[model samples]
Target: MSLAQGRSYLAIPGPSVVPDAVLRAMHRASPNIYEGELVEMTAGIIPDLRAVARTQHHVAIYMGNGHAAWEAALSNVISAGDHVLVPSTGRFCVGWGEMATGLGAEVELMEFGTKTPMDADAIETRLRADKEHRIKAVLAVHVDTSTSIKNNIAEVRAALDGAGHPALLMVDCIASLGCDRFEMDAWGVDIMVTASQKGLMVTPGLGFVFFNDRADAVRAKMTRVSRYWNWTPRANPEKLFEYFGGTAPTHMLYGLRAALDMIHAEGLEAVWARHETLARAYWAACEAWGQGGPLTLNVADRAHRSHAVTALRLGAPHGTGLRRWTEHQAGMTLGIGLGMSEEGDPNGDGFFRIGHMGHVNAHMVLGTIATMQAGFDALGLPYGAGALDAATKVISGKA
Candidate 1:
């Protein structure tokens, strides 16, 4: 059988569309691992990487996924039996808290469910109760891809300060790094962890952990952080080998370099504005579609929605069917609905998500919206017409 001739769209929450430049950069033989352009290029990544996080601190690169970065961040700052506060807005937050629990830390989870942002006042109350300051750190995800909720790290910092809590602020920026604006230093975040797959516009394999002086203090005082997960040598590596703590992910480095160049060339402000514009367009389209039925956005407020991903509920079991139809028929892959179902509900019975992240532009956004609208029509779902037009107008600033 013959396949479709046109391009196949990958609209998942992560492992997003990689740029041609990044792919070309990664297509090369292994460079000299010891001391050469690779080493020089690797050293230069720190400054650019710091620039991406909007920080002037140390960063540790790891040859693993976001999970590895999670372990590295936790292990470096919080030791066994320590206490940490995690504000759960979505699936990734819960997962990070669970990692802390597994690492022998007592975790206090302040869950806000999947559709809303975590209340800073509630977090303040929780921190204020810890008068002894037993909480060693606070784990917060900047953007939870599973539920498309974007929590406020800066507000969380303000809450911590209001309560006078002396805990490190750790952020999971895996899905928000390049797609959303995350100012680590401005947000008063101590440690920000991320991976290469999502907003960075690269394939999976590399993870990064950005740390400030506050986190360095914790690292110096913390006891028994694993060697593999240790950030001490990785951050302040005396030798090139210590940069990765072992063999480096060469091809991924190439891709990352290309992605960084793209980000810098376009300028961070432009990149952020583009993402905001596209996200608003997506929400506008969703609002139009939900006019006739129970198809509503997961986040009640637009401010809480992630710029990279949009989670929705159709109030029908046909959501999964719609997703499949969109992918197989329209060749547009949508993200699976995760962490949006209740205990009694079947697996994502009424939810679906659209990932409009890295390397996506106006045309790509329009294409995705058109394909989804097609699915809605094919499935006989209740939706108003001109949803795409409204979205296009929003993006183009015509309405």
Candidate 2:
């Protein structure tokens, strides 16, 4: 029998469970787009948005998703023939590099496998070798959503400085913005890009790009800056309608306002802490389940694991079956293992991901782990017992 519930849990990596407060805020009748309370209300969001990013830079709002933010960030600071050193931790980094390539920039990629974090020393070595400093920027993903690996942005900044490289340090924070601890200005990030869906707890469609003065300087020099992607008008809009270079994404703004309020109420620090705590608990649960089984964490080191998501390898076909059983029988949705399987292991037959970011609490996390454990048993997958007990102890502060 399934757990016929009042609400279906959307536990995938993104488009997370939106708060009712945010939904209610967005459900109202459409407000005037050109000049109205929505405009005035949105003006108030910049400071708070900067606060969440821990940035003192200028922020540009876009009427698109994370991919758009990536393009916007690239468009503002780079031109054709510009070289960007992309240190990819997973698929998203490669995606960002692809964007740069499409935009006529020369892309140099540094892959750290699917499960490993970017090696700062390796990055430093590469930068030092580029004596001409042709690498105009280093695009780093703060948390790679596909592989569930969190790179140390600050360390990458330090590596750049230590090597005396003048590359702009751009970060993709789409998956980690509100869930992980990120200090944009302090970390020397020239540009930070994110979307509303993941950790910000809002629906998709809105993307944000935060740029420091250094990036602004670069923007000023770009003779070919696309008017639509230009940050100047969006950042200091005299009329709110110009914020999007057109009609604003009104409902998304309302949802974002509510989501930001929820984040601030809990406090960014506390939010990060909660995610970290829950992530640890989930890891503990996974460790217990894999004790005598084929399941194992994709990333070997716990320190490199992402607070927003966890990637697991459950040994071949069983992994796919387990996820299907959980969703079909237990009514739990698990994230598909992205970028972890090669041609031989296609269909993500041996991998799965657990999304523990945004609008998730202890009970929701516990229930997810419990259901996954049930899936293992139902599928007759090899595993040890006591997974739930271990997870509960972590949540309850008993272990």
Candidate 3:
């Protein structure tokens, strides 16, 4: 008696649900790559991107994913033998450090584990220890999707200032860009990276690197940077081809234009509030379920949690069992517990993530919660009562 016959929901963190408007915008025939509407539309996109990041700085568009943005950002300011400090909160931050290491930079990671946010005080201490100031940059992730932990970027900036360190404040906003509140200019971020998916409500393929004058100055001092990854031409292209180093990602640009229009129409602040409220609804349900069951949120503190995603631990087979039940019985998919492996449950079968990011609304979030409750009952997994009531109250603004 399977009931999974319908349009399914993808509840993963990245590569989030694409808006129909974006799809319609991208569905047209490939336009002239050389000029015309594509070029004009792209010109408009740059300013809107700046608005989304709350930055008046320069941005380089790339025809790639978040990983490409990571590599592209590191390529410009980091050269071989340059020292970069990474305050790793979870998998993505460590992964970014590894990318820097691959580029021949000396990488140092300050591990903060998975459940908690990066410690600003510890970061300041590390910066103070770098007396010679060999560290050229500090790679920070605004939010690690895997752990569902949001680090304070402004505090990281304050740490550098407190230590009088000259290291560049480079941040990865791939997971938090539109969903969380970020002010790149206000936070004094030298460089920031994000992708078109997730909070942007566009399909994956476009990556962006936003840089201020300070970071561009570092690029100027670099002995050599790969021509393809260089930001100068991409940021201030003389022609259309130079905008992407070659052929532009035609459809993605259109999709991005539509997505950016959507963001601005709703207002960035309002979008952030929407994600925050939906996230709270999901959290309320999880908290209720955890009261009498094995279910628990990975990040214990509400202030440290990411508005885009919520990681949960149901313990061993139950986590895997619940995920399977939801997708098979109901037309919904849940995110796997990424980079959350531990003793006993080596494969991270004890965890799952709920993505409450871009293009998501109250009904969608509430429906996911109700479906999960059904999954628990169907799988005979013990859960506390009033889960729906708690979630609904939050959504209804009565909690």
Highest lDDT: which candidate? Answer: 3
Ranking of all predicted structures according to lDDT, beginning with the best and ending with the worst: 3, 2, 1
The whole-model C-alpha lDDT of candidate 3 against the native structure comes to 0.93
TM-score, per-candidate, Cα-based:
0.97, 0.98, 0.99
Per-candidate total of colliding backbone pairs:
0, 0, 0
Selected candidate, larger TM-score, 2 vs 3: 3
| Cα error, candidate 1, residue 158 (Å) | 0.6
The sequence of per-residue lDDT tens digits that candidate 1 reaches over residues 1-399 is: 222236888988988999999999999998888888988998888899999899999999999899989998998888889999999998899999999999999999888888889899999999999989999999999999889999989999999999999999999999999888999999899999999998889899999999999889988887577899888888888778899988888889999999999999999888888999999999998898888756789887988888999998886577787788877887788888887786556688778888888899999999889888878888888887678988999988996
- Candidate closest to the true structure, highest TM-score: 3
- lDDT (Cα, tens digit) per residue for candidate 2, span 291-346: 98888988889889999988899977877888788787877888888877866787
- Candidate 2 structure, TM-score to reference: 0.98
Worst 10 residues of 2 by lDDT: 1-10
Candidate 3 ranges with C-alpha deviation above 4 Å = none
Q: What is the C-alpha lDDT of each candidate?
A: 0.89, 0.90, 0.93
Model 1 regions more than 4 Å off:
1-5
By TM-score, how accurate is candidate 1? 0.97
lDDT of 3 by residue, 27-103 (tens): 99999988798888888889999999999999999999999999999999998899999998888999999999999
RMSD of each: 1.4, 1.2, 0.8
